[model samples]
Target: MGSHWSAASRARALASATRLWRGSLSQPLLTWALVLLTVVASVAVVTTGNWVPVSVLILIELLGAFLLRLRGMVVLCSVIAAECVGMVVARSEAFNPGEMLVQGVSIVALLAFAFHREQLGLQGAPGGLMLVDLRDRLAAHGRIPRLPAPWRVDSALRAAYAEAFSGDFVVASTAERGTLLEVAVVDVSGKGQAAGVRSLLLSGSFGGLLGAMPPEEFLPAANDYLLAQDWDEGFATAIHVSVDLSTGEYWIVSAGHPPAVQLHAGSGRLDIIDSIGAPALGVVSDLRCVPVTGRLLPGDTLMLYTDGVIEVPGHDVEMGIDRLMGAAERMLSTGRGGAEAVLAAVRASEGDDRALVLVHRDQS
Candidate 1:
């Protein structure tokens, strides 16, 4: 038994050492190794009398700036500086003043880039990769899950100024064994990148809250969350909808958002759901949201949108709603890409973010 335990301990130690060595290959260890190689190469160039150009060493230092952490970067820069001095002292005849000036400028630019990245708490390509991952995750949260055969849902969001991030976002989930579908459309106070950070934070929080608890409790919890942030421009508007996929029964709760529009297929007329109302989130404490309930029959459609769709500068919000209804009518009548088509046809405010969601019950 003692012999067996000792053998197992040796195997474990080997495994751990292997893991550590593999991990170090990508970071500081790799950087330090490169630094040492560069130093040797620099020494060879000085001893051999201009066989390898000093410019090549400068390029290696630039590469190190991208790959190394702050400490490693500082060490690499110091090595490069020392090599520069050595080249000037040993090979003064070959070193041109113009080339030295350009190399000096390059080093300064590299240092500036390193410091800027350090300020963001991340450096190099990893920071950009992290943001891409975040954006993709945020987009994934808004994806509507597949519903029953009779239900069709689609949504679209556009940022102001064609920016990569938007102030408007959606979160949705289905619960009760896929019999209940809940969706929330949220609009942060500012437009485009100005409010994107807050939008990202709220989307994750609201997405977690959507199907975790009773649908009725989501808004209040979200409100409490936003209020806790205590930001100067923290308030936001949102509309939450819960639908019974089996029965077509739905309950909508609003937080100072634009009224939802419903298309009655039988009458071929549009009606606004205006009863559900509450103050904007984060603006009030002890808020109570009263939900308005309804049912969708075969061939019926429900549309939810942000205020940017209707808020024209000179016109009242009512006119914008009317205009939206007209554009929606034309877009839905075509029966091809309802959500994307309506967003394209509708003339929304140019300077604000816009989003739209469409849910339809197909006729049997």
Candidate 2:
């Protein structure tokens, strides 16, 4: 009986140790362990005839800026102390004043950077990680769902200055058990990073509203949402499209956005869709949006785009539209590259964010 009890006790102890070991691998604890190891390495380097360069210790502390939070100060101090020890142990001829000055300047520069980063209310590299997470979430919200084989959809966005974040975004959904496709193309007021925060927030809200309620209700609800924010530069333009995949019936709703273009495969003609009209979102209260109805027969293509694709300095929007239409005609006729090619061919300037959404009904 005693032997059995002893075996059970051993098993419990082993489990506890395993848990403790795993727990020690978490943050702050892991950082502390790294600090301790750095200190040990510093000592070993100094005592072992200073074989390793002191610059190596400085490099470790520099890396700590990205990995450590408030603990980075401890690493800085430890490395400075290690350098001092190395200087003392080295032969008198080996102590170069120029090298020491350079090291001191590098350490001071690192300290200044750390203080600046702290003032921004960020710890380590969390700001960058947070931005990455935001970008991914926005992209996820914009991702188009898989559609039936007869229909194909593609979208592209380019931020002003080639930034990672854009003012323009596309969010899509399939409802009615995959018989309907709903896509919303939006362009927030500002460009690139200046509008990235607002863009991310609206993308999430708009994605939720799309396909969650009736198609006609999306823009009015989105307008109400934007009005609630009451921001000075809060207005935005958008095009919401709801299509019946099986029947080729569709509705186009515009909120002060540039018109959508439709390609009639049978006639080989392009028609600009600008019938539906409403104020830009957040511009007015009690907003009501009426959609323009249309049909997309087999081999037909519908294109939606933001103003950035057409607008340029010293030119009216009409001219830009004409240019876009010509490019679209060429692209549709050849059937070569997809949305990216059309955007590349039609964009007037890189001064603003551009986005394009193309929906094509395959030839039957």
Candidate 3:
């Protein structure tokens, strides 16, 4: 009963969110609704000298704008709405021709500007929808495998920025013969939109690269592509790993990115597989990415991450690494060490993008 109630509640919340999201996407309807509400509420409130309704309407407009990130429409609507509400609240029934004229002009100008902004793409893409698409791409759902049943791979990523686009890990996964699995975690250099766009552009190609070639060649090809672009100050760090599910043989390639950490199933020992490669991609040409071999026996877990997990300000990288190892040990011992759990163990710094991937060999 408890689970059923919880499920119902979640469904309602999702429905509400979906409606609100759809409303924001309907530009014509949203814009006209705001305009009509503001105009009607303003005129009614002013004529009746009742400010309460107008005030409430303004609050609703503000709430919608805040929730939807509709900056332009909200700003204009609030200004006009407040003007109407204030006139009524002040008990000024005498309609000042000048004041009314100014607001009328303001409303028209605002609507024109809003329409122009939309047409010119000055308003930018809606963050909510863009984030949804980005989240799906970052995870690469259909491309990743959850094979052999109960034994599964789990991953999570978080961006510090509100837009949810970041320079964190770019993930791509594939399985061969339903037994061999390959995954890559790449970190594009830089942050915010510049890095976000580059990461998006590279993620597609990298996804194909990870699936099309051997683990060792992934980084070399990635480096070649980056060098080809010849960007003045852009590079990327990455780790690519391929695993034989049946035999537990794993081959890893690192390109100036942090290593993959593994936990020994029998001894509860932790090992960090550091990156042994040339500088990060784009730094130089003809880069050779050395493959690191390891084994994941049943019950063992392997972890991959972006530098944002470590490299905390005022703290050395080694301390951050040690923090992760210690956290992983405790969580794994308690059967709570999932990808997100380990990431939470190491508190993130403000304005840093982070990502983590975990592959656990289920106990037989």
Error of 3 at 67 (Å): 15
Q: Name the TM-score of candidate 2.
A: 0.79
Q: How many pairs of residues collide in each model?
A: 0, 0, 0
Across 165-238, the per-residue lDDT of candidate 1 in tens digits comes to: 88999999999999999999999999988898899999999999999999899999999999999999999999
Q: List the residue pairs that clash in candidate 1.
A: none
TM-score on alpha carbons, each prediction: 0.77, 0.79, 0.71
For candidate 1, what is the total of clashing residue pairs?
A: 0
For candidate 1, give the lDDT. 0.84
Best by the TM-score measure: 2
Would you list the rank order by TM-score, best first? Answer: 2, 1, 3
For model 2, how does the per-residue alpha-carbon lDDT over 1-364 read when each residue is reduced to its tens digit?
5443343454455456445534553546656666676676666655665476556657766776665655555565565666555665664455567667766777677777777777765556545544556677777788889988789998888899899899999999999999999999999999999899899999999999999999989999999999999888999999999999989999999899998999899998999987458999999887778789999999999999999999989999899999988888888768977789888988569889999989999998
Candidate that scores best on lDDT: 1
lDDT of each: 0.84, 0.81, 0.70
Q: How far off is residue 245 in model 1, in Å?
A: 2.4
Off by over 4 Å in 1: 1-22, 33-62, 78-109, 123-126, 192-194, 312-319, 347-351
Local error of candidate 3 at residue 360 (angstroms): 1.9
lDDT by residue (16-104, candidate 3, tens digit) is 66666566566555556666666776667656654434444544444344332345475646666566657646656555656555555
Q: Indicate the worst ten consecutive residues by lDDT in candidate 2.
A: 2-11
